[model samples]
Target: MTTPLQPRNTAMFYFQAWISFATAMTAMGIGIAYLPVSAWVRGFIGLGALFLVTSSFTLAKVIRDRQETETMVNRVDQARLEKLLSDHDVFRPETV
Candidate 1:
C-alpha cells in the first residue's frame, strides 16, 4: 500500500517554539540571579528552573513519540481493512 505524504512543517512553528522555551528559561535564570536571597535559596531556585526546562523537553519528546506511535497504528489498521475488503468476494452465493 502507498503511504500518504506527511504535511510539511513551517519554519515559523519551530521559531516560535524555540523563542518561547528560551524566553522562559532566560526569565527564570535572570530572576534567580537578581533575587536578594540567601545562597541556599538561590541555589534551590536555579536548580528548580533547570529541572523545569529539562522536564519540559522530556515531556515534549514523550508526547511526540506517542503521537507518532498512534499515527502508525492507525495507518496499519487502515491498510489491514483495505486488504481484507479487497480479498472479500461479494457475488458468491451463500449457503443457508
Candidate 2:
C-alpha cells in the first residue's frame, strides 16, 4: 500500500518559509538604514536587528522541522511495505 501525499501540509510549510524569509529581509533592511544618533532611532535599529535575528532562527528551525517530518513519513512508508511483504511472504526460501 502507498500513502498519498499531503498537499495541504506541504503548502503550509512553504507559506511559513516564505513569510519568515521575507520578514528577515525586511528587518535587516530597516536595521541597516535607520541608524542615527537620536536614542529613538538607535532603539528602532536595535529592534530591527533583533527581529532579523529571530526570524532567521525561526526559518532555520522550520526548515529542520520539515526535513524531520519528511524523514518520518518515509520511515512510515517503509514500515508499511515491510508489513505487507511479511503478511504475504513475498520472498520465500528455497524448498527443502
Candidate 3:
C-alpha cells in the first residue's frame, strides 16, 4: 500500500490568507458600523455578524476535525490489515 502524501503549505500562503481574511472582516465591520440605522437595528445586525463569524469558525473546525479523525482511523485500519497479511504463513497453513 502506498503512503499518503503530506499536505504542503507555505508560510507565505498562510500569511496571505490571514491578511485577506482580516482585511475583509475589517471592511465589513466598518461598513456595518457606518450604516445609517437606529441603535437597535445596528445592534441586531452586529449580533448577526458576530453569530455568522462564530458559526463559520465552528463549522470549519468541525469539518477539519472530522477529516483528521477519518484519516487517523483509516491509517489505523490499513496498518492492522498490513500486519495481519504479514503475520499469516501461507505455506504452513493447514486449511485448504
Candidate 4:
C-alpha cells in the first residue's frame, strides 16, 4: 500500500540529511580556512571538501529518482482502483 507520498517523504528525509551534512561541511571548511593550521590539516580539509560535494550530489540524485518512481506507481494504482470501482454495476435492486 505504498503511496506517492511515501517517496516524497523519503526525498524530504534525504534532503534534510543533505542539509545537515552541508552544515557540518561548512563548519569544517571555516575551521580549516580561518585557523592557523598546518599543511597536513589543510590537505585533510581539502579532501573533506571534495567528499562533501560528491556526497551531496549523489544524495540529491537518489532522492529525485525515488520520488519519480513513486509518482509513477501511485498513478498506476489510482487508475487501477478507478477501473475496478467503475466495473461494478450496483444499480439494480432485486426483490428477495
Candidate 5:
C-alpha cells in the first residue's frame, strides 16, 4: 500500500475559510435576532443554529479521525506484510 500524503492549507485559504464561516454565522445570527417575531421564535431559531454548528463540528471531527485511523492501520498492515515477505525464503529446508 502507498503512504498517505499530508495535506497542506495555506494561510490565505485558512483566513478566507475562517472569514467566510464567521461572516455567515454572524449574518444568520443578526438576521435571526432582527426577525419580526417574538422572542420565543428567535430563541428557537438560535437553538437550532447552535445544534447545526455543534453537529457540523462533531461530524467533521469524526470523519477526520476515521480517515487518520484508516491510514495508520493500513501503514501498520503494510509494514507487517513487508516484514513477512522479507523474512520468507522459498526452497529453504524445513526444520524437523
Candidate 6:
C-alpha cells in the first residue's frame, strides 16, 4: 500500500510567503506615497508593483492547482494497480 502524502509545514509556508508579500507591498506603498518623485513616476512604480504582486499570486495558484491534479492522477493510478493486483491469483496451478 502506498503511503499518503502528508502536508507538512503548510501553515508556516503560507505564513512566510504572505509575510514577505505584505512586506514588499507595504514598502512599495510607503515609498510611493512619501517619495519626492514626479506623479508619473510614482504612478508607474505603483502599477508595476501591483502587477508583480498579482502575477506572483496567479503563478502560485496555477502551480498549486497543477500539483493537486498530478497528485490526484497518481492516486487513481495507484488504486487501479492495487485492484489489478488483488484480482490476480498467485497460487493457482497453471494448465496449458
What's the true lDDT of residue 30 in model 6? 96
Angstrom error of the Cα, residue 49, model 3: value is: 0.7
Better of 1 and 6 by TM-score: 1
Root-mean-square deviation of every model: 2.5, 6.4, 2.2, 6.8, 2.3, 2.2
In model 1, where is the ten-residue run with the lowest total lDDT?
A: 48-57
Number of the candidate with higher TM-score, 5 or 6: 5
- lDDT string for model 2 (1-96, tens) is 565574456788989988987887787666666655787777777786777678978998999899989989988989988898777864766578
Task: Give the per-residue lDDT digits (tens) of candidate 1, residues 1-96.
Answer: 788999988999999988997898888888999999998999998998888778978998999999999999999999999999988879978879
Each model's number of backbone clashes? 0, 0, 0, 0, 0, 0
Which candidate's lDDT is highest?
5
For every model shown, what is its TM-score relative to the native structure? 0.82, 0.53, 0.87, 0.54, 0.85, 0.82
In Å, residue 10's CA in model 4 sits off its true spot by: 22
Tens-digit lDDT track for model 5 on 9-51? 9999999999999998999999999999999999999999999
- Which of 3 and 5 is the better model by lDDT? 5
The numbered model that scores best in TM-score is: 3
lDDT of 6 by residue, 1-96 (tens): 767767677788989988987898888899898879899999998998899889988998999999989988999999999999998889978889
Q: State the RMSD for candidate 1.
A: 2.5
> Residue 64 deviation, candidate 1, in Å?
1.4
| Candidate 6 wrongly placed segments (more than 4 Å) | 10-13, 94-96
Model 2 spans > 4 angstroms off: 1-36, 90-96
Clashing pairs in 3: none
| Global lDDT of each candidate | 0.91, 0.78, 0.91, 0.81, 0.93, 0.88
* TM-score-sorted candidate list, best first: 3, 5, 1, 6, 4, 2
4 or 6: which has the higher lDDT? 6
